[model samples]
Target: MKRAHFIYLLLLWCIPMMGIAQIVPENPSSGALQSVQNLQVSDVPNDAGDEINISWDFPDDLDKSQITEIRIYRSTSASGPFRQIDAFPLVLDSYTDADDDETGHIVTPKDTYYYKIGLFNGSEEVTSQVSEGVSPQISFFNWGRLNVFIILGIYFALILYFIRASRKGREIYIRTLPGLEALEESVGRATEMGKPVLYMPGIDEANNIQTLYSMVILRYVTQLVAEYETPLIVTVGKAFVVPLAEETVRQGYMDAGRPDLYNQDIVRYYSDEQFAAAAGVSGVILREKPATNIYLGSFYAESLILAETGFLTGSIQIAGTGNIHQLPFFVVACDYTLIGEEFYAASAYLSEDPKLLGPLKAADWMKILAVGFIGVGAVLETFGIDLFPRLLQI
Candidate 1:
C-alpha cells in the first residue's frame, strides 16, 4: 500500500512539468527583436571556392537589453529540421558564415547549405524562415572566345551596313551638338598654340569601366594630335594604365603614320593621391599652358579644382565625368561637357567602332525594356493590384 501511494504521488508531481514542457505560449511577446528579412547570398570570387554571404534587416524594436544571443542554423534541405551550428552574441544584427569554420562547423562544396537565423530572447526564441539554397554551377560556353566572336560579328555587320547605306546614297543624318563641334576646334587650338595638349585620364583603377572608356577616347584624341604634329601630354594615375596608355598612344601614332613623332615623355604617370594628383596636373597646366585641356574619366571633389585651374589658364577645356556631383563644376567651367551616358558613349561616337557601339545600342534597348516594366507596374499598382515578383522568375 505504501509503495503504491509513493509511485502515484511521484507520477502526479511529474505530470504538470511534462505538460508545461509541451505547452508553448501562443503569440508570446518577448523583450528581444522579433523579425529578420532581406537575406541574400553570392559566390566568393577569385577562387575555386563555394561560399555564400548572408545579410538581413533586423526588427525595429531590437535592443541590447532584450536579446542575449543569435543562433544560426543550417540544413542541406530547404524544408528542414535544421541543426544549430553557430551562435553569436546579439551585439550585431549581421553575421557572416566565414567566421564559423573555426568552431569545427564544416561545409563542403558537394552539399548546398540553407540557413535559418533566429534570435534568442531571454525567455523565448524567435526564428525566421529558411533562406533559399546557394548552389554553384559551371558553364560550358567559353565566355572569353564567345565575347571576342560577338564583338567581331557586330563590328563586321555595322561596317557592312554603313558601307551599303552609303552606296545607296542614304542621307546618314546625325544630330549636331556643341560638344561634337568642340573636339575638332580643341585639336586645332592645340596645334596653333605651340604648347602641348594635356589629357588627364581620371584617377581610378583599370577594373573600372569608366577608365576603359577614357582609354578608348584617348586613342582617337592621340591619333588626331599625331596627325597635327601637336605635342600631346598624357598623365595617368594608375600604374596599370601606364603601359596600356603607352600602347594605345603608340598605336594611334602608327595609325596616323607618324610613329617617329610619338614621344615616350608625352605619356607620364602621376601620383595616385586625389589632391596630390590634381596639384601635379595643375602644375603641368600652369607651366605648359596647353591650348586645349581634356579631362575624362571618373572624378571626385578634385574635379572643380582641376577645372578651375584649367579655366584660369585660358585652355579650351572639354571635361567628361560619370560622377554626377562633379558635373555641375564641369558644366560651369568646360567649353564642352559630356553628361553621364554621353561620356560613356564618346568613344563609340568618335571611333564608330562597332565592337563598342553594339553594346551601347543594346544598353539603350535594355533601358526601354526597363521603362516598359515600370509603366506596367505603375498601372497595376494604381488599380490596387500586386504584380507578384516571384512569378516573373524562370
Candidate 2:
C-alpha cells in the first residue's frame, strides 16, 4: 500500500515536469526559428480611422512542423504592457486591427499604436520585435467607388438638363403604350354598360416602388372613371395602402371636377394573406361582374388566379407589373399588358408632367449610354484590350 502511494506521487510530479520541459524550451536559441522578416505596420487606406494594418513576411528558414499559429499584440505606446488582440494560423502573415471586440485595447484614429507578432507552438511562444508606430486616419474619399460617383453625376446632370428643356416647352417624343391607351376606353365602356370597374394595385405593400408607380397610373385611371361618372372599385391587399388608395381616388375625382360623386366606399381593403387577398378580389369580380378590370403593381403566385377570374367575367382586362414571371399570365388573359419598364414609364407618359418626364428622358439616355459601354467593353475584352473595363471599374 505504501509503495502504491509513492508510485502515484512520483507519476504526478514527473507529468508536471515533462509539461514544463516542453513549454519552457531547454535551449533558449529556439526563438531563432521564428524570427519575423520585414515586419511592417501602417494605416489602412480608404477607411474611417477605426483600423490599422499589420503585415510581416515569414522567415525563409521557418520550421513548419514546430509552429501552429501566429498571435497579434497591440499597445498605444511604443514600449507597451501589450495585450494580445488576435490569433490566426501560421500560413497568414497579416492582420487588420479593428475595434471589433470592445476589449481593453481600443483602436482609434488619433492615437499612434505599436504591434508585435508572436509565433506560437503548441506549448511555447516566440515574439517578434516591436513594430513601428502607425495611426488610423480618416480619408475624405474612397477612390474605389469613383465609377459609381461618375455614373450618378452623369444621371443627375441628364435629369436636370431634360427638366429645363421640358419647362422651356421642348417636345420629348414618347412611344405610345397600349395598356395606357386602353385605360380611358375601359372606363367609357364601364359607363355605357352600367357595370362597375375594378382596380387592384396588387398584393404588394404600400412602400414598394412598384406600388408607388402603380399609384401614379391609378390617379390617371380614377380621373377617367370620374369623368364618365361610372362606378369604380379599388381593392387593395394591404391595410397600409387603403388610405393611400382612398386619398388618390378622392383627389382624382376632385381633379375631374366631380368631388361630390366620390364616395369613401370606392376604395376597399382585403386580406393581407396572399391567397386570401386573391380570393377576396376574386369574390369581388364574381359578384360585381365588372365591365373592366385593371391590375398594376408587384405580384407572385396569386397573379394568375386574379387575372383568370377577371377574364372569365368577360371584363376588358388591363394588367401591368414589374414582376417578369407574372407577365406571361397577364399577356394571355388581359386585353392590354405593359411589361416591365413600360409600366414604370406609363406614369410619365399619361401625366405629361415635367417632373416625371425629365427623369424618364434621363433614364432612356442612361440606358443608351450603358448599352454602348457594354458593347465597347465586350469587343475590347475579346481582343485582349482592358481599357474600357478599367475606366468603368466599380
Best by lDDT: 2
**Per-residue C-alpha lDDT of model 1 across residues 1-394, encoded as one tens digit per residue:** 9999999999999999788867755434444467576766544433234345667777554554776787888888999979987788755656556524556655556778798888777678878878888754333454435545664565566556655654455444334556756887889888887877899889888788888878888988988998889999998877788988898899989988999988889888888788888888889889989888999898888888888999999999999989899999999988899898888777667766545555555555556756887798889879977772432422
Q: After best superposition, candidate 1 residue 183: deviation in angstroms? A: 1.2
lDDT of 2 at 115: 90
Q: Which stretches of candidate 1 lie over 4 Å from their true place?
A: 1-67, 70-85, 91-105, 109-173, 353-361, 388-394
Model 2 segments more than 4 A misplaced: 1-44, 53-72, 86-107, 117-122, 125-129, 205-207, 271-276, 286-289
Best model number under TM-score: 2
Reference-based lDDT, each prediction: 0.77, 0.87
- Candidate 2, TM-score vs. the true structure? 0.77
Q: Score every model by TM-score.
A: 0.65, 0.77
Candidate 2 lDDT over 157-209, as tens digits, reads 99999998898888888888988888888888999999999998988998899
